[model samples]
Target: MILGTVLGLIIFGGIGEFSKSQKANSLGQVKYLIGVSYPNLNGPWQLQMNKEIKNEIARHDDTRVIFTDAAQNDEQQVQDIHSLMSYGIDLLIVSVDNASTLTPVISEVYKKIPVIVLGRGVKGYDYTLYIGSDNQLNGNMAAKEAIRLLGNKRGQIIEVEGNKESLQAEERSKGFRETIQRESKHSIIETINGNWLKDRAEDELKNLLKSGVKPDLIYAHNDAMALGAYQALKQLKIEGIKIIGTDGLNEESGGLRLVKQGIIDATYITPTGGTSAVQYAIDILHKVPGLPKKIILRNHEVTKSNVDSYLTEGDNSSIPFIKKKERKIKLGFAQVGSESEWRLANTDSIISAAKEAGVELILKNADYSQKKQMDIIRDFIKQKVDVIAFSPKTEDGWEEVLMEAKNAGIPIILSDREINVEDQTMWTSFIGSDFVEEGRRAGKWLVSDSKLTTTPLHIIEIEGTANSAPAVDRKQGFNEIIQQNSKFQLLQSYSGDFTLDQGKKWMKQALKTYGTEIDVVYAHNDDMALGAIKAIEDYGLKPGVDIKIISIDATIKAFNSLKLGKMNFTVECNPLLGPQLMKAVKDLENGIEIPQKIITAEETFDQKQSKKEFSRRAY
Candidate 1:
């Protein structure tokens, strides 16, 4: 079977030269060489496979795992396979870049050494084994739920699909449309291409809405699209429309969390099966009987009712593990100075997490100096630490120094503030609160209550440090939300340098400029809000009553203010990221894959909830 009709790579040339130069081991052997080619190492799903496969390889004494990334290039994958075979790899596990273009290599490689195709299937390839979930079956399962949502009544389903070129998109779409047509009266009114991106899905769904279709229910091929579709309809004043999604990843930013938070109605679990794939490979190596040619791991729907089983916070035992090492992990953390209570909390969170995980953390405060931060990072490199993490002072001027660290073989993690490096591979992972979403939550809370929406509410935004990611993105998100309603007006917005003193001075100026006209004080953090509260009191006005105070970073101080009726509302920006960072570092040490961007889950709080949450608040 020739799955690839377009490829023209010559595999025989390399095989002959390599065989002449080196001795190929016989079939029965004590040692084995396992080669795996991942699609790319950036995504959460891809990282899971990398983790599981590497873990499986680590469990064996005589096995050596050789890894190469196709980096989403089909041609490069062909070259990578030939390179692996040149080293006489005993077995090969490949998540092909493109099933069609890379099928020729799969056909050639399986004949020499056993090959296990990772995720997708080629059209006409007979591989040694196939271990992955069937997207078409996942789509059919989604349709089954859609039928139940309709309950034998007629309704419309708007599907936000992945890219049209993708096989997963085609299969999921075909299965869904066929099932809907055959089993139920529900019709797919519109199917738009999202390119498998959240922003694209939002824009496409908005364009679909412009054509005047308020769907009865929506089924997105992925969770990001479903979330985007939800956001689009929400902005258009549509509510209560059920949405279903795929790839129920178990992370803070993934579909399982979305289901837990009620952001999306449902999502299907898509397994990485890296461990299972490697296990089957080991099984075949030992000639275990009754092994199937194809293995489809089961996937199920995750919704609000059964989401706790998939929740990370509720269970500490589920934290991903690596093999125990003799040396305690040595980590260097560069903080952006103690500018506010939030910074203090974030620093404490990192330290506490390090302490709990038994990691020896070397701490340094850059005092908001980009040069000083770079120097501190270089000092870590000099110490030859196991890993380095930092909250960058600014976005720019990081590419060169980061490249140096990467060259030195130190994995870097960005904590809170992001860097604008040219090459993204310079850093390992970014684990922090999404500042834009934090701002959106604040603005959404401000406008949610009907009583506050009655009149034109003039808002004074006390921003964070100038040009910092949190400051810039928080302003952007807040402005985007408040601009939706004409009743909300931004009277004045200025950066307070994310300091309490600056916040007080800025508040005084804003009050002087607009006397008795301020209806809301929207500070980017709790420290600034506390400063504004002091200014309000000094000016002979009661805080929270005269001016409805809304802020971000629900720290203990902010919660205390809320308890005292000094602060009305605050959105949470959790800074406790030690555990998450430790997990990534451990995985990196063991040659596992980690996501490019890891976001933390947060919540919005009113004065009433503050009373109950103040005691247990860690940040």
Candidate 2:
């Protein structure tokens, strides 16, 4: 198949050659080659996406897209990506085939160039950006539609699934099953594998019906499969079964048209994000600042009654517009606490940025109390603030409060820290540094320094606040890198609560217990590392010389300590998120879709580099 595709490319005068000729036609002009990988082009849904992408790119003379169809083969998709790379494509856009298998390959590609993942997301934060729909919500919508179709009657459901390994398939199945179990008097009696193809869905459903089992309702993961299931019912002379599907494409054979023709009852319009993906790809290639990590397009339900309105395409005549009220946008912000220099700098940046943006700011210091932060958020909701932003002290226990905020129609932006919540839609967006990457940088520095000697180095760790996002993610990231080398021994770890006192106390206890066995000390923040330095001095040992110190948060004090030969290395967790946060607040007020996760730019510093970069330290 690969050879055939290559030969076909040659027969068609080769897109790469065409691009080169185009580039040559205009001297000194820059042209970007974008590679688009699709799982298959067998269905209207995928074809529509390809058409939309091509149309959007046609508007840009400087960009050319080379598309590849994997024909629903996972290995073929990986090979196609390599082939595209061999052609020297500038960027890649992939609609993942199998997330489990494709994540590693995509991540490897991301190491070299920008990759835009569409439709389905892979395992990790390796890609440049993800543009896709909320498949789980589509599943929820499908379940609700199924319930409405039953309308006070209990029914058995037959679910026609797509590729099992696909993230979209898994999430859709999970959302549908969980919702049915929780809210409706319906049970999914049997699940048939469709593999996201019409013929396979028909064959599978026919086999299931041949086994003398029947269902009152059919829910397919996509429209093609839904249509196949409907055909199976027609062939088997089965009637009165309500059919629901996803991907409400408006093509002649799409879900919208199918619903209009009474072939399927309802469908959730899962936007392909093709046009948006192209736009974002251009922006990314241009190095646009403040772009979102993930753009989640909205999905709406389409049925026979509303299918005509959707078929009209771009008609906003029936939609009502509300006039905006001119007033200062009220922003309620809650700071975790001033436990360290970094925390103080972070708080000051937000406060100052809010003021500069002409936003009415109601700022509160949680003082390391999650309860206090929740109280402040509740108060913000009560005051009917336009926007609420807070840095969570810990990763859990914000679900109830956030749900309340969501119920009150208030948009929440998470600042600096993240939370562990099931309903992610409770928060609009998260703007913070990548904590895991910071930990990985610290671990990487330690690994690189360890090359100087072969002896096993025993390390002591002073962690930040227990169960906090930074502490947990940093530990995980550090461990991920250190596990690669067996010579690094982690002696012990202690929580510092991001406080200098706790850091000093923990370091003193570790020194007293382990004495000189500790070869290196890894602190989660600059304050803790400073405290560890004090404890090392009290222990009558050199800090940078005897026990090399590694920490996060490159405060001026840490830089000074590095200059004074007290701290060895400090990974920077940039705290200046003021501009980004204020911009997000204003954007949210203007009803813009914010990216799911916005990562702040950061870097690392060592003892020598610290002297040169010290003057540039803002936090």
Candidate 3:
């Protein structure tokens, strides 16, 4: 890895150089010695992180930093951590040597000094805080960019992975494979363990070429391995293959330069999060509250288009402050119970996004009860939080509580479901799906399908909760579309209560009445459709064929059903609206006008095509 070559020099040059760099600070009485340990001194990521740490310490006159390089040895890293504490260091910063064994040592160290772990995270322990980029997002974005470049064509991908023990290796690998699996035209022919090193990567690529396995692209975990892969390809007289990698290190030999020279096609700028780590460390030293237990610094993309601009940019300068001037914004949310797969996934998105944004979220589950949701919202108003958000179970009964919120001058964001409110000024915005459009899309797909057209169709509708906006709007939209078709017959329509059991029971009765006469089943959402599929199977009828199944809400359960050829189609009702909600909150706080309703994007999915994206499904 280029990162390795850049940073490795620091270790071989000797640790004395570290002391010389901090010589000026030695004159002052060291109030604190923040012990820092890195697993690998050879990588640029480690080098940059440590440099930022020292720079941050340079600003704090009362604090000095002590450093150690484990040289990728887990045992040495563990031992170094102990000795640093023995020297009476006030705290420890560890980028672990090994994610597994080193966790025990880290856990022990935390009992003494507050631990701020970076990069290679250990499992089964709770340290003070973890600081790093979301490696999974890195992998995911790389895969998507590669797919875009290789559009509508078959390609062989040679994946070069980081060290197996590293968390980035697991997350990046998973993200890449998950998306690649869904893109049928592309395949990972083989994965070479690069160990985040350049020489190893070169050797691996050379061997692959010698074996006559042609690769269309090379994907490395870091810029060094990517450079190695590019060199090996050049030596073999192979050209025109796109090479993708991570760690957008902006140096002569790093990703930015390589990308500018057209050596690497693209790279994800995985921030070292060192500056944030130092800032967080300072916060702990000052006993600041409201700092998150974890901090995931954002990652960015680098390509040929703006490589020069990126290269020109300097380091993020610090305006050091003992305490941040802006207090943490508290957000309150009333989540609907995990009644279905869609609801569960929505909750996950909100929680993860809030944590990442460093917003203090006061969350409550209403368990799909109107009374409970009202109480939750009322409590949020009482708490006087800056912003309040919720996904209501029913459209009714929110008017009173929403009015109370408006009276207190707190902005409200109605998530997923918009309620029956008289005053439009009561809520700031609605961030969710356009249910009516989702319904129309589903109906249109059924109407346009070659198999279902020109036939007298017996359609059985599985309605959701009686008064839910999704249920009512979806039914209305379907009715509006199918009303003109005389051949389309409503065989038997009833409420399934949006429950799997109820759907099964209703379908069982429908089966007894219609038998194979039921040609189509339009479920309000995926859960009911999944339930009806079970009921269809129990009656010895093959779903997606003898009786076509169509539903809304493109969730994991729905995807699995579609993949198995058990469900015919599902109109996507996307639930991952958390990031947008956070942005809206920030915009509102800045006195910017947000739209009254922020309608989310939706898509259509069929069994054959939806199979391609099942691996990438978050829910």
Per-residue lDDT of model 2, residues 1-619, tens digit only: 4653464355323535455335422333337878888888888888888888978987776776778888888999999999888878899999985999899999999999999999887976788888787787779878878988987878999999999989999999988998898998888999999998989999999999999987999999999999999999999999998999999888877898899999999988787888889998998899996566666666768887788888986322222111244989888998888788998898888888888999889999998888999999999989988888999999988889988888877778888898888566688778887788889889989998888888899999899989999999999999998989899999999999888888899999999899999999999999999998999999999999999999999999999999999999998887888888888777766655555666775667898899899887776
Winner by TM-score: 2
- The C-alpha stretches of model 1 lying farther than 4 A from their native spots are 1-326, 450-452
lDDT of predicted model 3? 0.79
What order do candidates take by lDDT, descending? 2, 3, 1
lDDT of each: 0.78, 0.85, 0.79
Clashes in candidate 2: how many? 1
Instruction: Point out the higher-scoring one by TM-score: 1 or 2.
Output: 2
Question: What range of 10 consecutive residues in model 1 has the weakest lDDT sum?
Answer: 1-10
Q: lDDT per residue, candidate 3, 35-144, as tens digits?
A: 78788778776777877776777777666666777777778777777767765777888887458878888888888778988866777435887777667767877888
Q: For model 3, give the RMSD to the true fold.
A: 16.7
Candidate 2 positional error at 342, Å: 3.4
In terms of TM-score, how similar is model 2 to the real structure?
0.72
Ranking by TM-score: 2, 3, 1
The parts of candidate 3 lying over 4 Å away from their true place are 1-28, 314-619
Clashing pairs in 3: 1-197, 1-198, 1-224, 2-224, 3-44, 4-42, 8-42
RMSD of each: 21.6, 6.1, 16.7
